[model samples]
Target: MNMNMDWYRIFWHTAKLGNLTRAAQELHITQPSVSYAIKQLEAQLEVKLFDRLSKGVKLTSEGMEVFKYVEKSFTTLQSGEDRLQKLKELSAGELRIGASGPIIKHFVLPLLDTYHAEYPEVRIRLSQGKTSDIRERLKTGQIDVGIVHFPFADHELTVQHLANIQDCFVVGHAYQHLSQKPLTAHELSNLPLLLLSEGSSTRKYVDQWFSSQGIQADADMELSSMDMLIELAGRGYGAAFVTQSFVKQELAEGKLFQLHTKEPISPRAVGFAARRDSTLSIAATRFTELLQ
Candidate 1:
């Protein structure tokens, strides 16, 4: 189309006010300039945009259709401009974050709390799911950054290791009567165990460790939430496999005891992931800095 944005704006104003003189005054241009712009636009589109009415002007069928789109475009442009202005003024901007439930609860929440305390005007939007799920969101631009466990497979993303995590089997005070000596993999296989759902990183790591020792675990229950697993273990449901840091408070308070393992589980890296080429929001960058 030969019509430029300037002509579209002129046509939009004229259609709204239904008078060339009024539109020109609103636009701070001469009436002929408004008329010429509309005429040019109509000629380019090969459609009559306005019908000369006795009192003023009325949109023809084609004019109404064009005006409908122009109206929506201008509204959207105005909204974008307003948002940009707000961002420039530091009055508003959204921070989208992706994380698993455990990480969000144990790590992201505290950092976000501190961030919100400092920047109360910034809006935070959090999405929680499995590490793989969060990774997908990060890749697709659905979230600005992700808090994920280590060993993520995506090569296109940049990762920053924030903390080292150790996995441990925790049991309640009811099991305190057991000896404090380290339990062999073969011995642990015979005890009732609570674990995360199959295919989870935690579950995979546990399974690998057990397999290497030629032991078959007696998994009595599968739970989705680490908090629930801790609660159940505290109630003597079974020995639950969880991150040591996650249950540090329970361990310290004597509500739970860590079962001695013949071989301590290797520590895994927990960290932030972001698209290699995407620009991060100020809030997200600041939060990442705190994690680092």
Candidate 2:
């Protein structure tokens, strides 16, 4: 037999209130309309659902039995709706992120902490690598989004500018007594420098700047990890070329000092990158919104 959900809704409401007049008032219908719905449901079910009393009404045993099932069904339906609403509100889902070391430590990590506090059920997956590797993952659909340094060459990716990161030379406390006055790019060439590995974007920018000024200096050392560079610089190994944001705490704590250069290294554009053709997951979109 065909059954309407509205009929069940009416029946559920009447069962809860146990009075036709009260059920009608609660459902914003007239008493006759409420009675007619009950009659129709009873006719379809072939059962007596209610026993009329002087002041109110009560459910028959059969009505109570049917209602137990209805109550469970409707409860489950409400629960399903609540879960969907939470997903819409960004309380669930997963966000996959790709970022270089400095960006992850200095920026993305703090933002992720905030995101987690607000959306505990949303899972965040972070992959750390060089800027080039991160960009490659974004293109290949391995990562939903990336934090990269610019002059990126990808024409098919969308870039959203977040901040400008200033590059500087950091040194150990032993160099603290050195002149704070800015030195020309030529003078900077004289300092032994602990630099990031050759292919890194930071290294590329430094190389280009030196080339522009007609001064190519020999590196004191080359390291693959930013943490290693920072540690070596703190140990008075040599000056390390790094972003200002990455060493702010070290500079403040006197573990590292910034070496001023006359031709200030141009700031790199730091931002979010996503493939042009891909749709972002719900969690990724929410996190991106938070970044902005």
Candidate 3:
């Protein structure tokens, strides 16, 4: 049966007040409009909803049952509106981010700390993976933002250049003498190399650098973790290619020394990536703004 939902609303108020005139006053309508709406609702339901009295009205048995469901539905709708308002105000909700372990430790942590301080109610989720893994997470809507090495291109993702990072070869006491003189790319390539695994962005960048100088450098050891590479390099296992900013403490304390190269490595960009078509959550948007 065709029914006007407003009739149910009018029926609810009329039943609650037990008077047509009072329901009309509450709904800001005339008494006749309230009476007509209840009549229409009763007609559509094929049941008598109310019985007229000398001074007011009384709900029929069926009218009381319908009121129970209508009241619950309105309450649920009101609760949903309240939740949305909280999210929009940044007082609730979650922010998900993805990045490589080194990037998270050296770069993203500070920004996350600031965001958490300001919005303590918002939950933060972090996922550690390689740049390619981050890209996949972003496309699948698993993460709200991704911190990645620059020069990465994907039509499905939007990237914002955040900072510049310089990659350099470093050594420890065993190879400290190499730091005294600037060596050409070929000279540096002759030494044992400690490289990240093949598919990683840093590995790709380092390989391209050697290729440009007509050197096909080979790694004596390859590892997935930057921390492991740095630790091994500090023991003089080999020259570790790493981001300079990540080892400031080690470099300052003489635990590791930066190797000087005649061919200066150009600085590379680091950036924030997000799905091009997805709108960021309020917490995610605020976090990005904090970094900016």
TM-score of each: 0.72, 0.70, 0.89
Cα RMSD to the true fold for all candidates: 5.3, 5.6, 2.4
Model 3: per-residue Cα lDDT over 130-193, one tens digit each: 9999999999999999999988899999999999999899999999999999988898888889
Per-residue lDDT of 70 in model 2? 93
Report lDDT (Cα) of residue 127, candidate 1.
Answer: 91
Q: Quick one: how many clashes does candidate 3 have?
A: 0
Model 1 lDDT per residue over 1-292, tens place: 4549999999999999999999999999999999899888888999999998887799999999999999999999999999888776547887889887788898889989987887788899999887888888998899998998888767879988888988998999777654388998887777788998876778778998898988767579987788888999999987889999999999999999999888778998888899999878766777788777
In model 1, state the lDDT of residue 145.
Answer: 88
| Model 1 regions more than 4 Å off | 1-82, 88-90
**C-alpha lDDT score of every prediction, in listed order:** 0.87, 0.87, 0.91
Would you list the rank order by lDDT, best first? 3, 2, 1
Clashes of each: 0, 0, 0
For model 3, what is the error of residue 76's alpha carbon versus the real structure, in angstroms, after optimal superposition?
1.5
In the predicted model 1, the residue pairs found to clash are: none
- Structure candidate 3, residue pairs in collision: none
- Estimate, for each residue in 126-168, the C-alpha lDDT of model 2 and write its tens digit: 9988888988999889899899888876877898999888988
| Displacement of the residue 172 alpha carbon in candidate 1, Å | 0.8
Error of 2 at 249 (Å): 2.4
lDDT of 3: 0.91
